[model samples]
Target: MALAHILIVEDDAEISGPLERFLRINGLATTAIASAEDAASVLASDEIDLVLLDLMLPGEDGLALCRRLSAANGPRIIMLTALSEPTDRVVGLELGADDYICKPFDLRELLARIRAVLRRPLPAQGRPRQTEAAYRFSGFAFFPQRRFLRSPAGLRVPLTGAEADLLLAFCQHPREVLSRDTLISLTRGEGFAIAVRSVDILVSRLRRKLANDDLAAEIIRTVRSDGYVFQPRVLAE
Candidate 1:
């Protein structure tokens, strides 16, 4: 396997210096940038596989930068934030951050998250050579390659990274009751330490986006004791 190139977008030399050195020593290519603006330029000029973006920066805030980068096909982002609230983490995920590590995090945990994100299959935009596939269900079409959902009326429904991942898992295994743990593992990867409640939030968000009428009659059905299941017949091609 090729060495993964990582961009460290942290302003503090105290943090970036040792982090960059550690990553380099571990057989990864590293670039340390102090500001979001420089990070943008470096990302454009270099082939960076992942970004360790600090939420607090001198110029453009990390959240704004993450929003902009998420809108386009760019490097996978793992936000670095001091905020520990679940809402903050959800917001970051909703804005397209692939993962996040709180400030003063363990280097081992950070390295594990970096590896987990890297191990994930690259999005369609990142892997253009792969054949595109679409799944159709309940008047909605999901283009996994493009990471977008199309309504029955031919309108595009936007989806956050987490929502898209969860929806795809359901569509892939229609009618099967998937437990919270199962869903989390399928969408976020095995050994990912995310709260199961987050799955409930993603499910609610997806239902709001995909269901036109009563959510109870939506394509995704809550299976009381089992978990959740996709009620619609799904066809993939």
Candidate 2:
């Protein structure tokens, strides 16, 4: 396997310099840019496997950039923020970041996160059968390969990366109640340190997106003390 290419988007040279040197020394290809404006150009020119994005930037903030890049399916984003609040982390995840690390973090931990995110299989890759690429559930079509969701009326619904992962997990195991921990593991992989509350937030977001008057029945039903279940029948194709 080729070494994963990392793009470090940080304004502070003191941080970006060491980060670049450490990742390169650890056998990964890296490119460091100070401003978010330069980010578009670099991403356009290179096949960046992952991005270490700083939350605070000169023009466009990391959250905004994450939203934009994620919509384009450009690269896997791991937000780097000085804010340690749980809400901050949740916001980052909701904005489509694959993962996040608070600033003043250990280099080893960051490296581990990078490897973990890279190890998580992307929707477009590693599927043995092409038929598994799309899933149909209750008039909703989920195309995992393209990370797209189409409503019953043939309208396109935008989904974040985390939302897509969670919805895919539900579609794959419809009518089965998945515990919070199990859902986290299935969507984020093992060793990811995400709170169970985050799962609730994700579920709420998905429910809102999947809601409509025509589809009055709840597609995802809460199991009281347990996690939740995809109530609708799903056909994988």
Candidate 3:
């Protein structure tokens, strides 16, 4: 496999230089930028796989940079901030950072986060692709390559970002009673610290989109305390 290219957007030379060397020695390519302006220049090149962005920069704040990066569809970002506040972390996640690490963090943990973000499967956004080890269940069809989910009557369902992730988890492990905590971990990214009630809200929204007015129990049956299950036979594609 090709080495993952990482970009470090940190103004502090003391921090940026060491992190760059650490990652470089670990079979990864690295680029270090001191400001958001320079980082934006790097992003326009479209070559980076992951970004390690600092929250406090000189000119534009890290939060603003993150928002611009999200808007421009730049590479995946993992925030590196000195702020230890939970609100700062939550805001970073909401702004689309894949993970957040406070300053004075271990290098190993940072590397692990980088690997985890790189390992996540890409979402389907175009024409469908086929996969043999695939399944059809709960009124949805799974094509791994395409990441496509077609309804039972052959209607194409357009899932939002969160909905696609939650549905992917359900289809992957059908019939298993996944608890609210488990579901949240599977669907919500690691940085998400939302209430468990959010899962119910997601389920309700997904159900309305999938069922229209038909509200059938067989489609994502909720177990009293065990959570929910994808109650359909999954055909391997």
For candidate 3, what is the lDDT?
A: 0.73
Which numbered prediction scores highest in lDDT against the true structure? 2
Q: What is candidate 2's lDDT per residue for 37-128, written digit by digit as tens?
A: 89999988887889999999999888889989888776789999999999899889888998889989999989888887777656553236
Candidate with the larger TM-score of 1 and 3? 1
Q: Give all candidates' CA lDDT scores.
A: 0.84, 0.87, 0.73
* Model 3 residue 190 distance off true place after TM-score fit, in angstroms: 13
Single out the weakest 10-residue window by summed lDDT for candidate 2: 123-132
Candidate 3 per-residue lDDT over residues 122-144, each given as its tens digit:
54333274444566765567554
For candidate 1, write residues 102-155 as lDDT tens digits.
Answer: 999887788878887787655654445666778998788998655689998899
Candidate 1 versus the native: TM-score?
0.90
**C-alpha root-mean-square deviation, candidate 1:** 2.2
Alpha-carbon deviation at 219 in model 1, angstroms: 1.8
